[model samples]
Target: MAKAFASQGDLEEKKTSFTEIGRGLWAFTAEGDPNSGVIIGDDSVMVIEAQATPRLARKVIDEIRKVTDKPITHLVLTHYHAVRVLGASAYGAGQVIMSDKARAMVAERGKEDWESEFARFPRLFQGHESIPGLTWPTTTFSDRMTVYLGKRKVELMHLGRAHTAGDIVAWVPDEGVMFTGDIVEYRSACYCGDGHFADWGRTLDRIAAFAPQSIAPGRGDALVGPDMVAAAIESTRDFVDSTYRPVERVVARGGSLREAWEAVRAACDPKFADYAIYEHCLPFNVARAYDEAQGIDTPRIWTAQRDREMWDALQG
Candidate 1:
């Protein structure tokens, strides 16, 4: 193959930032790596999006300790991607929550995703051996579910799909803050290998309708104000559109996957070339976009071997 995934060579440690987006609500962002959110309530705390492994999760737990010693009683996952869910055991949260559709994906393709991601990016899976196994939710909800950490109410809702079929966001009504898991990224690139391109914009629109004062995105820095929140949502929308539109056009003309890839790069590179994981996500994003444009409703499961074959095809 002419190229391996950009993630394969990403060994540099990202600077992790723990910022307060709202009172008692914090965002743990590692540059452009996966981000997690914290909500400290009257008695306990709730964490959103565990890191890739127990060792990485310890970093978030350490940050939480600095702010409050309250037990993390709930761990709410926004989706079922391996990088977001595998570190779950480290939280020790009695309640692990995910959308019912996400839980089903876990049973169906979770193991394959874990293997594929591990093969693609070893840096995120810092302590792969320590991961207990595929992380399963102790509790699952269909559309929306509310969990209260004492008096604090955190609403987890499936506001349509963008990054994945079961993608959801956590909203804090009092703070007017939302933790959008991969649905809205800041300056970082959206990993759309398992995304729903046609529905992404509508999902983003639903997030904007709430007019969140702040947002803890799936990646990139925490958005602290309404302006930043709005900007991120639109930029993410643009990224999704820019990626899919070119591929859609190519597919309509009966172009090959390689041609679609070239089309996507021509459209997206000038805008997103420098974004985090941009190169790593490009091929997979292009492939999925091609499939979606060709009428594939569900994303095919990605295994380690499939990742290699897909990469090789794109290279040729």
Candidate 2:
């Protein structure tokens, strides 16, 4: 197990908790771990995101078994991050779904992301050998797709670029519940290596317009009720704003990366001190935020080597 960015050490087994959102909707959350949502339709099941590995995903599958015997027919990749997509094969899903842009990212940088994430958090990659390589979506959409889980309607929309160029969300309209990928983490730190800070804010606004009664964020516990949902969105927005804006100002003043990092630390450390993965994410966040602030529209690719070099130079 690798150490968590905050004072807490690496997590072993995630404490799984199943929360019923709607009639057939369930959220599988583990203390601050990546979340996976379940939708049991008329005859089959749809899993929102795959975890880090098959071994880990099996735990989620086990939980699903306790509820229903429906075979998983669809596995949705909210984005192309390795941690969220690698365990996809375990589901044996008849169809793997994602945005077209997400598939493109997998083609471009999937291997690098896999290596980088493995190096960053080995604990999450339990039974790494069981992985059948990178996951690719079998079906993809450009903008939106509507899937019917029996009578329930599940709307998948590419709600603009936020966490990644291919980020999307799954909204259950009749239930007024949304599963926001990494775009809106509840209490967990936002990983911004491939994020677009400004666009993310806009994406949040779009999500807000929906007025979701329940929200299953990328990490942390599921937010129940309207007030908690609103707070979660605001918290995520504040995290992005506080982390990026000051770093941008420093970079614009010709400050060194080290100086800019220090500036961000001083500003964010106090407010987001207890947030999960803050230290692990800050360096990458600052780099991306700085680049975006400098008018870089697209995020640069992140490799394992680059990750370490940047960490040592700026964070060490």
Most accurate candidate by TM-score: 1
Q: In model 1, which runs have C-alpha deviations exceeding 4 angstroms?
A: none
Off by over 4 Å in 2: 1-11
Candidate 2's residue-wise lDDT over 187-249, tens digit each? Answer: 789999899998889999999999999988999888889999999999999999988889888
Q: Estimate each model's TM-score.
A: 0.98, 0.96
Query: How does candidate 2 score on lDDT?
Result: 0.89
lDDT tens readout by residue for model 1, 1-316: 4665658888889899999999899999998999999999999999999989999999999999999999999999999999999999999999999999999999999999989999888899877899988999999999999888888888999999899999989999999999998999988999999999999999999999999999999999999999999999999999999999999999999999999999998999999999988988988899999999999999999999989888777753
Per-residue lDDT, model 2, residue 150, is 71
**After superposition on all CA atoms, how large is the RMSD of candidate 1?**
1.0
Model 1 misses residue 202 by how many Å? 0.2
Q: How close is candidate 1 to the true structure, as a TM-score?
A: 0.98
